[model samples]
Target: SAVISQKPSRDICQRGTSLTIQCQVDSQVTMMFWYRQQPGQSLTLIATANQGSEATYESGFVIDKFPISRPNLTFSTLTVSNMSPEDSSIYLCSVLFSGGGFFGPGTRLTVL
Candidate 1:
C-alpha cells in the first residue's frame, strides 16, 4: 500500500484567489494521481503526474486551471488558478494500489 499526505486540511479563501496544495508519498512511484471530491460527487481524476514528464490532466481540466508539477518521484503539487465558488471542493492525492487506488485525507476548500 502507498501512504500519501496533503497540506491544509481545510481553508476559506476569497474568490479569485489561488491555492497550491502539496502531496507527498512515503515511497517513489511511477504515477501520482490527483483527484477532486465535490460534496456529493464521486472522485474525479484531475491529472496524472509522472516523474520527469509533464502532467496529463483529465477531461474538464486544463493545465492553466490546475497546473501540476512533479519535481521528484515522491512529491507533487496542484494549484487551483483563480479559484471561484465552484472550485470549492475536496482536493485529494492518490496512488495506485494492488486492487485500485488509495487517497489522502484531502484538502477542503471553500471559496467565499
Candidate 2:
C-alpha cells in the first residue's frame, strides 16, 4: 500500500497567479493521476503522470494550463498555470497500487 500526502493543503491566490501542488507517495506506484473536484461536483480526471515521459491529459485539460511532472515513482507535481477563479477547486493526487487506489489529502485552491 502506498501512503499519499500533499503539500500546501490549502491556498488563496489572486487571479492570474499560479500555484503548484506537490504530491508524495510512500512507495513506488506505476499509475498515478491528478483530479479536480469542483464545488458540488464529482471528480474530474485532469491527467495521468507518466514517469520520464509527457503526461497524458484528459479531453478538457491541456499541458499548458495544467502541467504535470512525474520525476520519479514516489513524487509528482501539478501546477495550475495562469489560474483564474474557474480554476479554484480541490486538486487531488491519486495512486493505484497493489492494495488499492489511495488519494492525497488534496490541495484546495481559491482564486480571488
Candidate 3:
C-alpha cells in the first residue's frame, strides 16, 4: 500500500494568478496521476506524470496550462497557471497501489 500527501490542502487565489501544488508518496510507485474535480462533478484526469519523461495530459488539458513535473518516483508537482474562476476546483494526486489506487487529501482552490 501507499500513502499520498499534498500541500496547500486548500487555498483562495485571484484570477490571472497561479498556484503550484505538491504531491508526495510514502513509497515509490510506477504510476502517478493528477485529477481535477469541479463543483458537484466527477473526477477528470489531468495528466499522467512518469518518473523520467514528459507528462501525458488528457485531451482537454494542455501542458502550458497545467505543467507537471515528476523528478523522481515519489514526488511530483502541478502548477495551475493564469487562474480564473472557472479553474476553481479540487485537485488531486493519485498513485497506483497494490492493484488499487490511492489519492491525496486534495487541494481545494477558490479563485476570485
- What is residue 83's positional error in candidate 3, in angstroms? 0.3
Tens-digit lDDT track for model 1 on 12-107? 999999999999999888899999999899989999999999999899999999999999989999999899999999999999967788788899
Q: Tens digits of per-residue lDDT for model 2 on 41-107?
A: 9999999997888999999999999999999989999999999999989999999876778899999
lDDT per residue as tens, model 3, 18-91: 99999999998767999999999999999999999999999999999999999999999999999999999999
Decoy 3 TM-score against native: 0.97
lDDT of 3 at 11: 100
Give me the displacement of residue 67 in model 3, in angstroms. 0.1
lDDT scores of the candidates, listed in order: 0.92, 0.93, 0.95
**Better model by TM-score, 1 or 2?**
2
Off by over 4 Å in 3: none
For every model shown, what is its TM-score relative to the native structure? 0.96, 0.96, 0.97
lDDT winner between 1 and 3, please give it.
3
* Cα RMSD, model 2: 0.8
Residue pairs with backbone atoms closer than 3 Å in model 2 (clashes): none
